[model samples]
Target: MSNLSATSTAQNSSTPIVLTIAGSDSGGGAGIQADIKAISATGGYACSVITVITAQNTLGVSAIFPIPLEHIEKQLDAVFSDLNVVAVKVGMLADCDIIKLVAAKIRQYRPAFLVVDPVMIATSGDLLLKAYSISTLKSELLPLADLITPNLPEAAELISSDVPTNKEGMEKMIGKLRKLKFNALLLKGGHLIDDENSNDLLILPNHVEQLNAIRINTLNTHGTGCTLSSAIASYLAQGNDLLRAVQLGKDYISQAIAHADELDVGQGHGPVNHFFVGHANVR
Candidate 1:
């Protein structure tokens, strides 16, 4: 990697800086909260520019208020002007204006790595992104992403097709998504009802890699996607290639899920234990 690329690699300095643009989950299970926890746990310094604030808990999201575009712009300016941000993770842009604004600034900065998580709906069946902004998200934001992480429902909605239930259907759906021109795509299969293992497909221009894990049975899965995507960005900022970053990220999330029951945070669906091993315990 060039010196420019190495500028934000955290291990080179005290820590590599990774920025997350997403909503704020007051419940602390997902959104910017989950992003920060996952990035820090995976060895990156995390910064955030929040797009919206939701009145929510593990049960569901009740209300959402978007941050003004100007404030959002200011947050980006403050961070990029000083921090050598190596990678970025984007999630839950609530409206067309916010989506466009985020896209514009990210385009300007041109960070070394960008992970876009198409977070349309919450785990509790609440819609996070505005229905009208779906088009803007697809046209303005997705193409600029280095990697786009979309679950089965999101992939189906993105292409206006039925949800892929099997591995063969997933490959076909990934082909349709590839035409959108992202550098790579990770089509997550955790939502597959019949699968004993959570199998995710990573599709690059010339290669395809399958990452599978024994499905952890737990109700504490509220922030799995956010954690996974941020973990990938953290690894990428640490100078790992796309495939290696993704591989490491999957392992991190799996461990988090396995240990999620340890955190007694919420009454309904809880959060994964991002800091599965605290610093004092690290040997």
Candidate 2:
């Protein structure tokens, strides 16, 4: 690896200086922690503003600490006034006010890539966002997005109904989601299991591509969604195509899951290997 100076890094910063405004996961498996790791792993400088803090582990989320609206704005102000942010990845926007606040800031500083991960539910079946925030995200946020990455359940919540389990059903759901006005939609299929592989669909303007990966067999698959979205954001910052970024992001998550170790923190599910530790970037 070449040594990178802060000045040279800042001056010759890669194509994107990615930003993620999301909640914090204390376990460091997901949320802001995973975002930074994913961004760096994809070779981008990550700037983050936390929307809320979750006292969470592999077992479950215990408490939620929401930052004040003004504090969230202040964090954005500090970053926007100084650093040059290239792409924005939104994770858990906890409330309606946060959705509106982030939407306004994003419009003011329209970055090259705006990826929205409408984090309504986690893999552990936790309700991360409120009902009204859904409206705020659709009305005030989706219009400003370059890409919207929604998992199966999120797709259902976004369209206000059930998402189809098969390819045909996915097409119908993607159609409903496209009405929200995003340039692209990466409908993740982690929750959808047809046979064995976890298939994700990327719906762009002229075409749709299937991103297929063998599902790593492990219960230590927490934070996979957040990791994928942030990894894509980081790649976008580094000037990768949207489809390529998503593809690379999927590969990264697969590796993380395959190499996931027993952190032994929680009893139910385990966290992914974001650090990738002895694990190669096999994807």
Candidate 3:
């Protein structure tokens, strides 16, 4: 009975709970699988609502099957009823119906933080969302997000213009997104032809932060974006500020990339080692 009492107390005061409404990656590289790993690795409890499933590996995505809209809500309702979600991250909203359902749920539950990682294309040039869903995602889903982490390609599509490749042009692009009324814009600078390390520029309403990440020279970078955003969600769920969360997330991913630089997972590309051993402090 005493042990049960302790367990109940802990349950009542759950440290941090983050939810990921995303697709499932059977390879455990990206999607809901990566989301869970990233959250747990950063000291947060993960609750997931899978919107789709993909038969995928490091080489490429073989097939994708989106889950029904009703089932998506069922999963969300189940989690919301039981857990107090502090932060939510969304990825791979394959269709507009599912996106709308998710947006409504976000409004209803109103988590403290929400991060949207628009999974438009796969690592190996696969289209994830439908063409019709693009407009819906912009007008309906993105504005509600506390932060939107978009790469060079995604930022281009968001504003329907060419994304400037250089720093000056990139900052200008980030400026345009700032006027969109989002809490934060983490514009990833991965596509620019630069040196070894990558520069990610983050623009906010008042402040601007720059993250300098050492781009690991390896094929194992399949789930990087998913992992980064999930780590941010994990930190936010624990009551960290957006800027702090972003920094911590960058650090976490940098370490993950460094640890997995040599491990080979598939024929073409690979994944980061989320559970790398011998780390003294995680999160």
Candidate 4:
């Protein structure tokens, strides 16, 4: 595993810097846009290194253009060289090369916390990561993550198993997931549509935790994964422990989803209100 330990840095600034290395959503709902909103909303300074650019909106992803590998490296260098980045949230890496490049940079910089959101498919059912890149992601990138947030489909893809439809099915996959080389796993159970409550499993090396919240019924669920992971990264950057950060992130996302109806964005799945509580700190 790449060095999971954070490199020492001066603690002079009050606002913690959080960097997000992900794709860009032109719709301004998910990807880099959502990460920035979530980080700032949760009281962290946000920075980004966009890996891919998508012509996307609430409806769906129309087209994708991966940034050149050289430019991607330049973006990583620009952020890590200047900012005192405390945590990183990775999402929507387009291919094997991008994934490998990102893993190399993380090894070199060794940020304090690494949150990997294995974004294989968008909420609209559009494929994000290439089918062949799954193996590269699991082998080269995931093992380096401090925490990997994978939903049902993503988890199934990582393990080459069937997607779980219920709590029992989710539990059965625990042993399979434990075999993977990663520090911690947050198995998001939001895909269980039949359940009235949303429950997520946090699988640590020594312990397993189940986080539960009442399901908020809404069609405006676009960018939920991106928002939650970025919120967790922001909390981690602000010095919260892993468990605390996950809990806080869950709360923020639930609220955002609950209040999602307030925004009337696109024709299909709309975005959650990142600033749902007005200008007040989301924490």
Q: Which candidate should be chosen as best, given lDDT against the real structure?
A: 4
Per-residue accuracy of model 4 over 61-124 as CA lDDT, tens digit each: 9999999999999999999999888889999999999999999999999888899999998999
Rank the models by TM-score, top first: 4, 1, 3, 2
User: Local error of candidate 2 at 271, Å?
Assistant: 1.4
* TM-score, model 4 to reference: 0.96
The total number of steric clashes, by the backbone 3 Å criterion, in model 1 comes to: 2
For model 3, the stretches where C-alpha displacement exceeds 4 angstroms are 1-12, 278-280
lDDT (0 to 1) per candidate? 0.87, 0.79, 0.81, 0.90
Would you estimate the TM-scores of all the predictions? 0.93, 0.90, 0.91, 0.96
Per-residue C-alpha lDDT of model 1 across residues 69-184, encoded as one tens digit per residue: 99999999999999988889999899999999988998898887889999998889898877788889999988888889998888888888998887778888867887776778
Candidate 1 Cα RMSD after full superposition onto the native fold (Å): 2.7
Q: Compare candidates 2 and 4 on lDDT and give the better one.
A: 4
Give the runs in model 2 whose Cα sits over 4 Å from its true position. 1-16, 262-265, 277-283
Q: What is the lDDT of residue 64 in candidate 2?
A: 89
Error of 4 at 262 (Å): 0.5
Give the per-residue lDDT digits (tens) of candidate 3, residues 1-283.
0011122322344678889999999888899999999898888888899999999988788889999888888999999888978788999999988989999998888777789998888778788888778889988888888889988778877777686777777777866676565667899886675656678988777888899987767667888889999998887776666777799888888788888766767776688887777541454
Reference-based TM-score, model 2: 0.90
